[model samples]
Structure formats: C-alpha cells, structure tokens
Target: MKICCILCDRYFTPDKMQIKKLRKHPHRIILCPECHERIAERVRKRKKLQSLKRHPEG
Candidate 1:
C-alpha cells in the first residue's frame, strides 16, 4: 500500500506487516524508513545524553 510519511510527506510503499498494522490501527502515524531511522537515532542520542547526565563517569 502507498503511505505518506507524516514528517517528510514523501510517498512510500509499506511492507506486508506495516500494511497489516495500519489496517488494524488507522489512527497510527506512518513514517518513511529514512524518517523513522532519523527519529530513532535522535531518540538514542537523547537517551545517551540523559544517562550521562544522571551518572557521570570519570
């Protein structure tokens, strides 16, 4: 199925599993692979920063 990424607004074809999930939950937001990876990397960096702030190692 053709889906548009909410962030990038680019059209992409989702795989079978993604299609099934979207069908099951229409309210869910879809992101293209690139956008998804970008967001994931940002989250990982944020989490690492938070951990470092909580526990400092010298």
Candidate 2:
C-alpha cells in the first residue's frame, strides 16, 4: 500500500517496509528511508551529546 511520509511529505510504498504498527496508525503515515535515516542520525547525535554532558568523557 502507498503511504505518505509524515516528515518529508513524500509518498512511498509499504512494500519496501514491514512495520505493522506504523501501518495501522490512524494517519497511516510512514517515513521514507532517507528521512528516517536523517531523523535517526540526529536523534543519535543528540543522545550522545546528552550522555557526554552528564558523564564528561575525556
């Protein structure tokens, strides 16, 4: 089925994916690979920075 990426507003087919939860969501919105990767990378960097702020790694 075709779903729109909530973040990038691009349409993509769910054939390339298999996330049942997202598929069943009310908006039926999904993230394209490129947008998902970019968001995940940002979140990873933010989490790493938060950890360093708390631990102060040398």
Candidate 3:
C-alpha cells in the first residue's frame, strides 16, 4: 500500500521508490527523500543537543 508523507503530504508508492523512516513513532510517519534528509538532519541536531545536555564538553 502507498503512504503519504507526514510532512509534505506527497503520495508515494512503496513499490516504486525507497521510503525512509523519518523517526520512530508515535512521531514517525513516511517521508519523501528530500523530507527524509531534512528530518535526518534535524534528528542529528537533536541528538547533538541531547549529548550536550548529558555532558557539557567541547
């Protein structure tokens, strides 16, 4: 079954293109490649913030 991206609401056929998981649900929803990259970057930034919160270091 095809799923629509949570961000852009773009319809995508799973059989046609690669669908990358943006984040683990309950927040997770399907995302297109561009959205996927953007989300991934956001996740990375959040992770960095988490790490910084845990330990304040250089």
TM-score of each: 0.92, 0.69, 0.52
For model 2, residues 1-58, the per-residue Cα lDDT tens digits are 6677888888877653446766566555568888988999999999999999999967
lDDT of 3 at 36: 86
Question: How well does candidate 3 match the true structure in TM-score terms?
Answer: 0.52
Candidate 3 lDDT, 1-58, residue by residue in tens = 5678778999767533343442223355557677888989999999999999999987
Q: List the residue pairs that clash in candidate 3.
A: none
Cα error, candidate 2, residue 39 (Å): 0.5
The predictions' CA RMSDs to the true structure, in order, are: 0.8, 2.5, 6.0
Which residue runs does candidate 3 get wrong by more than 4 Å?
1-4, 11-29
- Give the per-residue lDDT of model 1 (tens digit) for 1-58: 6999999899999988899999999999989999999999999999999999999999
Instruction: Give me the runs in candidate 2 sitting further than 4 Å from their true place.
Output: 15-19
Query: Candidates 1 and 3: which is better by TM-score?
Result: 1
Predicted structure with the largest lDDT when compared to the true one = 1
TM-score for model 1?
Answer: 0.92
Model 1 regions more than 4 Å off: none
Best candidate, TM-score-wise? Answer: 1
